[model samples]
Target: MYTLYIANKNYSSWSLRPWIMMRELELLFEEKLMPFGNGSNWDSFRKFAPAGKVPCLHDGESVMWDSLAIIEYLADRHRGVWPEDAKAKIWARCAAAEMHSGFTNLRSTCPMHVGLRIRLKAISPELQAELDRLNELWCEGLNRFGGPFLAGEKFTAVDAFFAPVVFRIQTYGLSMNTQASAYVKRMLALPTMQQWQTEALREKWREQGHEKAVLAAGDVLEDKRMQP
Candidate 1:
């Protein structure tokens, strides 16, 4: 059996990637949730993760860390983790890789907290540029490969890569074009996404640093999901 180690669902965007991928693919694996905060969790995490990060996969004797690397490893073992067509596969890989590497401004300015609904006081010029680029990338993939998902009608690793972005947009009430908005709705409505959000809302341990930054930027919006 495979074992997947992850951090807090509400704040660890990196951990969500392989998680949603495995869940959506209906793969069976044991989940080890390690909430981040102090020295003890860090020490435990380091034993399984060489980089001292969450979302590490333990497949028997072999341990694989890094979200993208874990996804690729699962893809090799399972079908539909990525698109099947060669051309579509290439396009999906490019978009996923781009997401894996770029978009620092958005990631930094608007950290994802699935349990909170926040309204940013201001969207910085750099952040807006990143959002614009993200919209273009989404549109390009949707139009190029045909709609309903990033690469096609079926969900792929590209979609999993961008899943955290959808959460970021919804949680912070960020704006997007019509197509992008529709896509976000579809992503959020996914059963796996819903499951993650529900689990996140139930988490009691809040990352004090993230909460402080978000509260300073804007007020937390009232929502039923925010209620315990």
Candidate 2:
């Protein structure tokens, strides 16, 4: 069985990537949650994560550390990590890669905090540009591949990669094109996403770093998590 080491579901956006994908695919694996700054042993995480990061996957002897790497590893061993169609697969990879490497503005200005709803202090020009880009890309994929998912009919790795963004969008109420907004609603309504958020709300350990970053970005309108 694969052993997936993650961190707090409330703030660990990277961790959420592989976890939600694995859960949606019904892949069996043991979860190791190493929450940030709450007795999170870097040495223990680095033992498998190598970079002291979450979302590390240990598949027997093979240790995969980065979220994107974990997804690719699953794609190699599993059948449905990506789309079945060749064109869809390629587009999905590109979209996932784009999400991984780009969108620094959105990633920084609006970090994923599933437990809180915040009215952002400001959306800088850079962040607005990135948000516009997000709408454009999502619309393109939805238009190109038909309805339901980024690549095609099924929810593949591409959708999983953007799962955190769904929460980020919710936390900030970031606007998007109508179709893209509908896509966000569909993703948010998923049973697995609901499960993740529910679990995230149940976490009592609050990381000050995440909290500080959040308040620095905006005013917290609501906090659904149980207090630490």
Candidate 3:
């Protein structure tokens, strides 16, 4: 049996990657949520997570850490986790890897928070550059691969990697071009993504560090998305 250990649904972008991939690919796995900053949970998480990070996957005796690593491991074991076509697969992997390593500015400036809505006081030039690159990348993939999803007609790991970006954009009310905005809407509409968002809303645990950073940047207003 495959088991996935994750952190808070509201704040852990890394955790969201593999969780969404497994769910969208219809892979059956036991989910273990470890709320970080909790002493007991952190200690328990360290027992399995090699880097002491969340989103670790346990497959029998093997423990896989890192979101991209876990996704690649599952893709090797199962079909449809990634695109089948060689060219499409290459582009998808490139995009996913880029997401894994790049976009530090966007990640630092606009953290993922499904449960909170914040209006950013400003978008720095660095963040704007990252957003522009992201929009271009998404547009290129959709145009090149002919997608309703990132890689093709069906959802793949590429989409899963960017799932948190969808939440980031929504939470901060960031703007993108027409195609990018449409893609974000499509991602938000996925049943698996919706499930994560609902669970995130129900989670009361907050990472004080993340909360402080977000509060310092912008005002936390009512969740307009939830308001009737």
Candidate whose TM-score is highest: 2
Q: What is each predicted model's overall lDDT from 0 to 1?
A: 0.90, 0.91, 0.89
Model 3, 2-31: lDDT tens per residue?
999998898899999999999987888999
Error of 1 at 108 (Å): 0.5
The global Cα lDDT (0 to 1) of model 1 is 0.90
lDDT of 2 by residue, 1-228 (tens): 999999889999999999999998999999988778754567777767788888899988889989999999999988989999898888899999999999999999998899999999989999999999999888888888896999888889999999999999999989888998999999999999999999999999877888888999999999999886
Candidate 1 lDDT over 123-226, as tens digits, reads 99999999999999999989988979999989999999999999999988999999999999999999999999999888877677767766876778854345
Candidate 1: RMSD over Cα atoms? Answer: 1.6
Clashes of 2: 0
C-alpha lDDT of residue 158 in model 2: 96
* Candidate 3 residue pairs in clash (backbone atoms < 3 Å): none
Candidate 1 wrong stretches, greater than 4 Å: 38-41, 223-228
Models 1 onward score TM values of: 0.95, 0.96, 0.95
Cand. 1 TM to true fold:
0.95
